[model samples]
Target: MEIVEFGSDDSGLVARFVDVSNAVRRHDAPWQHLQTVHAATGMLRHGWDGEPAVPFLATHGGDDVAAGEWHVGNYDNLHIAWLTVDVHPAFRRRGHGTELLEALVDRTRSAGRTSVGGDGWDNELSRSFAARHGFEQKAVEVNRRQLLAEVDPALVDRLHAEAAAVAASYELVRCPARTPDDQLPVMAEMVSAINDAPIDDLDIEDEVFNAERVRAYEEAHAGRGITLHRLVARHRETGELAGQTVIGVDRERPHLGNQHDTSVVRAHRGHRLGLLLKTGMLQWLREVEPQIEEIDTWNAESNNFMIDVNEMLGYRIVGRALAFQKSLA
Candidate 1:
């Protein structure tokens, strides 16, 4: 097996890598939504979340058989490297994945990193690989999906009403398709609230969020043809941003949307702002993107508060995934 490192500019090879990765995901977890090559390429080329990617392709018989991408976090977690290795289902069990993983870990160690992190299905094969490779199970992330068609619009309205009753001091701001300039700074603060999410045993740093990072994130999504719908709660008294939630809908796949980053700052947690933000966006989507059928979200299993909110909003667990990490001793 020949492992060749592919550069960010190699769009052809990166597209092939995305093909292989999507194939693996579909075959391994059919319930999960497949990612777009455009998004993967954008992340690799543009470093979404401020982490540059190093992609490797494994070639055999003059064909790109398997692929892996290693990303070293630069924002705040420089000591950790995250890698995803996907061997085409047809090429699995031939030692390609093992080779790619070993090479990724070696590269991370060479870069003076302390640990390597990756996520995988909770299936037996993935669990066994992590066990055999000395990767410690750090956390379990639950992937949940909500069918919008089955969602009762009245439920959202009722939730909105209930939240409104208690959250009277907070005003909800709805930003469709783009973030307003006036809200950019507070949006950065809300983005930083994600750092409060349970990281479990994963050795990583808190992401630094500012207007610049928000713009880069917006650009990356736009490059992938994804439109974002956001709802942010602000305290009417102090004019402080309390909480926010975002839903991303792909133009190519209008039937599916992604639930990303629903967070409430520490000072504003007890006011049911999370429910307000989520339901507010759901109501907006019902009006704007009625074609969206389902929205998927992932949360750490330990996040009972968020899970409770999701459960209340009709999101059910579809699959279990694991985050694994290995320390370079």
Candidate 2:
């Protein structure tokens, strides 16, 4: 077996890594959206958007069969090293995955981190691998898919009507792929609402959002051939943003859209803003990107509120992911 660390902007190596990664995704969850080489390259180029990442390649029997990206950041739980690994289906049971994971753990320990964390599809192999390696289940995430073709037109109308009736004191604002300058600060602050989501025992911290970080995301999404559509409910009289939601459609995968984030400020709760924001965004997609066939979202299993909203919007569980962590100390 051979292990090589990828260098910056190495498109060829990144493409190969993506090939192996996507192969794993296809075998594990065919219903999931496929990632393009462009998107993979963008992630490699940014090193997970500048959080310090080291990607590893594993070759067994002289062929690349597995890959892993290990990351750490001061912004997150600094003592934990975040890891993501993908092993081609054909390479499973050959000890390639185990060897590569050991290398990742060794590197994490050398970096002075107290723990290593990762997420994987909640399958027999995934669960057994984590358990064998002494990693404990930290959280579970549901992968929900909404088929746009299955969406009922009448339901759409009803949701829009119901949201409008309750949101009489607020107005909905829609924006294209980029954030406007004036709303940058509010948009940045509004993103913090995601911190309220339950993470269970995962060693994670609330993310810091600011104008620069939001701009970085915009640039990354644009580079990855993804277009972001945003909707925000604004207070009618004060013009303050009461809630916001975003949907992203990748040009490379036109049939798949991603439900990014939807959050209603604490003070704005109970106005059905979550529903109003989501339904309004869905309506916008219906008009502008009618070709989108399905949208996928991940929610913590314990987040009943968002889960209920997704269920009402016709999303159903297609798969699951489990977060696992191992103590290095």
Candidate 3:
């Protein structure tokens, strides 16, 4: 078996990697729940404008058989994000995962990064691999899903009414497609508020979630998969952006939903804008994306406010995962 590093807008090979990855874990997610070819290629080519991510494809027999999508960032915290390996069921235990991982870790050490971090579901393949590599289970992330089919329709209506009444001083607006170029700067500022939320064991550098990185996130991952609707609420008279919620649909198979983000600006708190924005967006999602069967979201376990809101909305815990780390030294 041969391991070859592929880079610089290798769209076709990247698509092949995604295909193999999807095929292997095909049933794990409700829908495909992944970026389309264009989105994946965009990341591979110039994610964060060459900020130290090198996606690799493992190939043999004139066919690209295995793939790894990983990032070698400062993590702005001296770590990594979403570091997962993909080996076709036909090619498991063939050592491709190890090769690709080692390559990135080696690169991180050489680049002066201080640590390596990763996360995976509380499933065998993930936990076993982490144990074998001496990575400890440092923190766990719990995932919860609320079945729209089981949720009380009347409750959704009442929540909408109460929330709308409280939020009446603001206007709920969904920016169709991307925000205009003129709005990008404020969008950046508004988006930065997200970092204010909680991340328990992940050593995320709080202040590093700045305008630059926020815009990078908005551009890279925001508007993909299904209808990417970023619902923002602006003060009615002042026209100042007050709160926001983003709901996503699985474009290929519309029945699945992902709550990308829901937040209220510091000043916008106390008004229940968080609840208002979320329920409003949920209503929009239900009506327009009715086929959506499941909507999943996560927050730090200690985040009582958001979790309470989610509980009220009927989101039930589904699975748990740990974000683990190892020092490169």
Question: Which candidate gets the maximum TM-score versus the true structure?
Answer: 1
Of the two candidates 2 and 3, the one with more favorable TM-score, higher being better, is 2
Tens digits of per-residue lDDT, candidate 3, 132-197, equal: 887777777778898898987789889988988877798888776456767877776676677778
Which window of ten consecutive residues has the lowest lDDT sum in model 1?
43-52
Whole-structure CA lDDT of model 3 = 0.71
Off by over 4 Å in 3: 7-12, 23-53, 59-66, 73-82, 87-96, 165-169, 207-226, 236-240, 286-291
Q: Which digits, one per residue and each the tens of the lDDT, describe model 2 over residues 1-329? A: 89899864787787788888889878998876576677777666663334447888888777898999888876557788888888889888888888989999999899899999998988898899999999999999999999988899789779988988988999998875678777779888888788888998887778888877777778777776778888888999998888888888888778789888888888888888888888888888889999999998989999999999899999999999999998888
Candidate 1: misplaced stretches above 4 Å? 7-11, 50-52, 176-183
TM-score, predicted candidate 2 vs. hidden true structure: 0.93
lDDT of 2: 0.84
Please give the distance, in angstroms, between residue 119's alpha carbon in candidate 2 and its true position after superposition: 1.1
Using lDDT as the measure, the top candidate is 1
* lDDT (0 to 1) per candidate: 0.85, 0.84, 0.71
User: What TM-score fits each model?
Assistant: 0.93, 0.93, 0.78
Clashes of each: 0, 0, 3
